[model samples]
Target: MKLENMVRKVYPNLMPYVCQLADLPIEEMKQALGKEQVYKLSFNENPLGPSPKAVKAMQEALLQLNLYPSSTGDALLARIGDKEGVEAKNVILSNGADEMIILVAQTFLEPEDEVIIPEVSFVQYLASTHMMGAKPVFSPMKEDLGVDLDAIIERITPATKTVFLCNPNNPTGTVIPADELRAFLKRVPENVLVVIDEAYHEYADDPEYLSSVEFVKTYKNVFVIRTFSKIYSLAAARIGYGIGQEELIEAIHHVRPPFNVNSIAQAGALASLDDEQHVSESRRINQFGRKLLAELFDELGMKYLKSATNFVCVDTGRDSGYMFDQLAKHGVIVRNLAGYGMTTSLRVSIGQPEEMQAFAAAMREILEKEEK
Candidate 1:
């Protein structure tokens, strides 16, 4: 009897994550192209880098490398609770927002249950649902590229266990209006969980946009998932948190592993919270970069979606894969949306001022050559 033949029949072989072309390692691309300078604008990472306070804290935390991290991550939870106006008991921190997504699936989903997500949104929602053998229902976005709350609401059935909404949605960078969200929440069944993934929360300053944390207080089934990876520039630290009712959070805790969030991440996240100046500066850079990119696109006569997040999705009027390769040769990297079914579109992250300028110059050269 072969060991491979003895595997569980119901378990499906999972496919490896297929990343966007722009997300491939810059160093590898640089080596291939023989280019020295690489501008990474594919991951929506903070251009200014990590908070100074966070860097200092992580460096000092090296002294405790021999010791185990705090299992509860209580101090960081307290800071998050204070900032989000939620009780520490109602918050669950994870290695990253990605971990939180898996935790929710492990806690709430069962075989045959339905999980709703936007068609062009985060890939994790589908991956988590598949991991649990749950059915994933993709609701298509509206004409303007925003989440169609009405479509999502109409698709909900008793089998629907979770609905993941990415505010200032990824790839597209469009947001669901506060009024629309409030209306949608009211229509959601109490048993169905509503997950609001606000990974780019710090970048969104639109007057009509509402933070989902406020709903965690009023609704038992709502969870607001946030991360330090964005504005805090703590992507490498892998720290994020989810806010929900105390009972909901307790259920997730039951499935959480001990010391799931490391001490260094906890230290970095806590210190980053206190660094308001850094947060403000990151926001300023993102806002300026977004504006600059938009203007560049306008000058080039390229069509682009107005962005509320650090990235903008633009129609390049050519095959994105070819364009991605072209940009890589020029030492400029950006996200190719071919995997998202937008073959002619590319998602570009706002970088430092000089890097954005470089991207603009590279893009102009690429487009001009295509014309000739």
Candidate 2:
């Protein structure tokens, strides 16, 4: 008669996705630190904020809040199709890229199926796989913390249903080269699905980096996921989408919830497409901030990954938990990697120049105090 017995068998064994360390609200953190200003660089948000056009569109769309939005985000799909050079039929909209990950698992994963996941990539991929009662096969990353495409290909078995690839992967911020990924795709069995999570796609400027959207055009099994949360500064709106072959998208529609994306989010995302200037400026500032952070890490004699995304992962040569607490006390909040089994590393998001300078000063002060 216990409610716990009614829950799915997989629910008890699954681990929650932990993306942040500090539990306190910003106001509470400020009060505790006794600081006038706190720089939250824990989340990889667009430092420039949301686009003006998107904000204006969301404001105008507010008048129609009483009505439900397009059940499938038809207009936004059309615009995304135009941008990605795919037909409207090739895309599926979701509450966020996170939900799309879940929907894909719901549609394709059988209880016994196995999903190949990079060892240190986004935690949601593992969470989603477990939700469907699927076996998750962890593929170890290379020594440099880059996705090991070759190793993943070798791990494929007949039971493998899907392979999750996070391009310019979260935390590590490393990307698999286009040639290597193409080669990997060719070797993968057409029957197995490849879910490419490209949440940080716009931030990657490396010439070798190729969006999996190109693969989606030719490979019926390749599904590319993207979001407005990262570059469009619409993290709060929670709008994300997936691109794949028309048939693949059609299959996923069976599990999609009605009116999943709200009206204001749709309007903002639609208008964000036209705001090329804002996108460009955001990318520019990210590039500048990344370079500055890399230089600072170099000067500090810390080992850090060469990032292709908006955040950089650096080894602190001390307990990451301690580093996180000290930095938080100094009004600089960064991501602690303890949840990911990385005890001596932290992931710092790219912020504005002034914010980055604040982080730099905080680091120097902390290291000096430790030396003393």
Candidate 3:
């Protein structure tokens, strides 16, 4: 038998989308850039090390590698319940929040089903929908980069299976304030799911920010996703969770693989939750870093979006592909935006003092060279 003939052929003509979906991102380009020790600000990864306590816990957990982790992940579930003020029955953990997003698509979407998303928010929402052969409907942001709630409300139809609300939205960093969120949710079709992704929530200190954890109990259609990656500095661990009603949680769990989360990740996440001091300091440093970047961008005469998340999107008024390459020459690596349909912008993640200083120095060099 010809091996090519034996291949599963679901996507012979449509395979490019799946291939490009896993294509190398800007952060991944660092390895091939020929830099021995480049500064990485492309991915909004916490530059700070893991909490001392979490590090210690992971070290101790290494010895227990012979045993399988708690299939229920009770300790991690209990900790999340205590913090979010919900019982363990209402929560489910995954390999990462991305996993939950995928499962949500699998649980609700049929081919050609409509999924509503903010035009400029997380791209994964679109990717997940398309993976299931569904359609994406978008409500583009206004000039300030904030979600236009009225625009979103206008698009809801009986075909809409879910609407992803990435408050403190990715790439742009704008948030949906409490009053606006309340109004939008009230009008959404009851049959559709609302995925409120708060991956960067711990970094969001705005008192007016209403995390969806509170809405889960009230709305049967609401699914709230949280990640250990941002504030907890657990990106490498790949553990995230969702909160919703009992039936929804059970439905998603059916599609999840047994032991989808590995042992070490569960241990580190459990420890990281209790590291209040680390979270506090990370927030403080992130605020300071935000201020520093704003001032630098102003001095350079470039326009930039104000952020509620850990990264800021800046408009360089030049092709971002050019800016990305020039900065790479000087050992500074920030995210290129051509993939986001922003050819004139780049995103910089908040970094520690020295990292920020180095990035600023490299940026100043690039702009000065351009002026000549």
Candidate 4:
């Protein structure tokens, strides 16, 4: 007679996503720590905030709130096509990159299929695979914490349906180089799909880092997913899209939800794409912040990874869970990477100049006290 019991029987062993342990809301953190303000450097959000152009567009679009959004997101599609030089038919917009990941799993995965992902990569890859009752094959990362193309290729088998590659991978911001990817893609089985998740593409400045958008034109099995949430500062808007060959895109759209991208999100995303000035400014700020954080970490005698995205992974040489609490008390909130199997490191998002300074001060105070 219990609904919970019945639901559990029907959907047994559903693996829930383990999201990054983000900071509490600023006001909430202030209350908890008895601080005036708390510097939040947890989720890799843009420190500059959303684009002014996108904000204005969303404001104006509110007048038409009563109407439903364009289910297919044609305007946003055209903008993406123009920017990426792909046709509208090749793009499938979603609520965010999150939906894109789920859509791919739903559209392609069979109960007996397998999805190959980096061992410590995005949690959604495993969660989505489990959601579809597919097997998740985790390929271990390389020494530098980048995707091990060789290991992933070795894991491919007859049951491998898709491979999820999070370029400028979350938690650890390392990227797969263009040459390495080209070689790996060549070796991948033709039947298996390769998904390139570029949620933080705009922040990637490495000369060797390549966008997988071009691969879509050459490979039928290649799908490139992008989100406006990062550098565009449209995280709350939840607008993202997947780009692939026309046939693949058409198939995914068949499984997509109606009006998945709401009106405000579509309007904001479209405006964000056109605001190149804002993009440049965001990149500038991110680059500056990244450099500043790296320098600070070096000065603190901490080990950290060189990041391609708008966040730095720092090793605090102490229990990261304890470190995180101490940081909170010092009015700084950063992501504890223990969930990512990293107990001594924290993933800190690149914040504004003042926020970074505050983080540096707090980190110094805690670490120095620990040393004493």
List, residue by residue over 15-39, the lDDT tens digit for candidate 2.
7644343545567767777888989
Q: Across residues 250-326, which tens digit of lDDT does each residue of candidate 1 receive?
A: 99999999889999999999999999999899989989999999999899888999788999999988899998888
Question: How close to the true structure is residue 15 of candidate 3, measured as C-alpha lDDT?
Answer: 39
50 Cα displacement, candidate 4 (Å): 1.1
| lDDT of candidate 3 over 1-372, digit per residue (tens) | 986688544234233444221134445554667556677788798878689888889889999999898776888998999999999989899988899898898888998689999878887798788778888898878778788988988898889889998977898877788888888888888898999999989888667688988778888999999999898998888999999999999999888888888889999999999999999999988999999999999999989987888998999999998888788787777888787688899989999988889889998998788679
TM match of model 3 to true structure = 0.93
lDDT preference between candidates 2 and 3, better one: 2
Alpha-carbon lDDT, every model: 0.90, 0.92, 0.85, 0.89
| Cα misplacement distance, residue 183 of candidate 2 (Å) | 0.4
- TM-score, candidate 4, is 0.96
Residue 83, model 1, lDDT: 86
Candidate 3: segments with Cα more than 4 A from true spot: 1-31
RMSD (Cα, Å) for all candidates, in order, is 1.5, 1.5, 2.8, 1.7
The residue ranges of model 4 lying beyond 4 angstroms of the native Cα positions read 2-5, 8-12, 15-23, 32-34
Q: Which candidate number would show the highest lDDT if scored against the true structure? A: 2
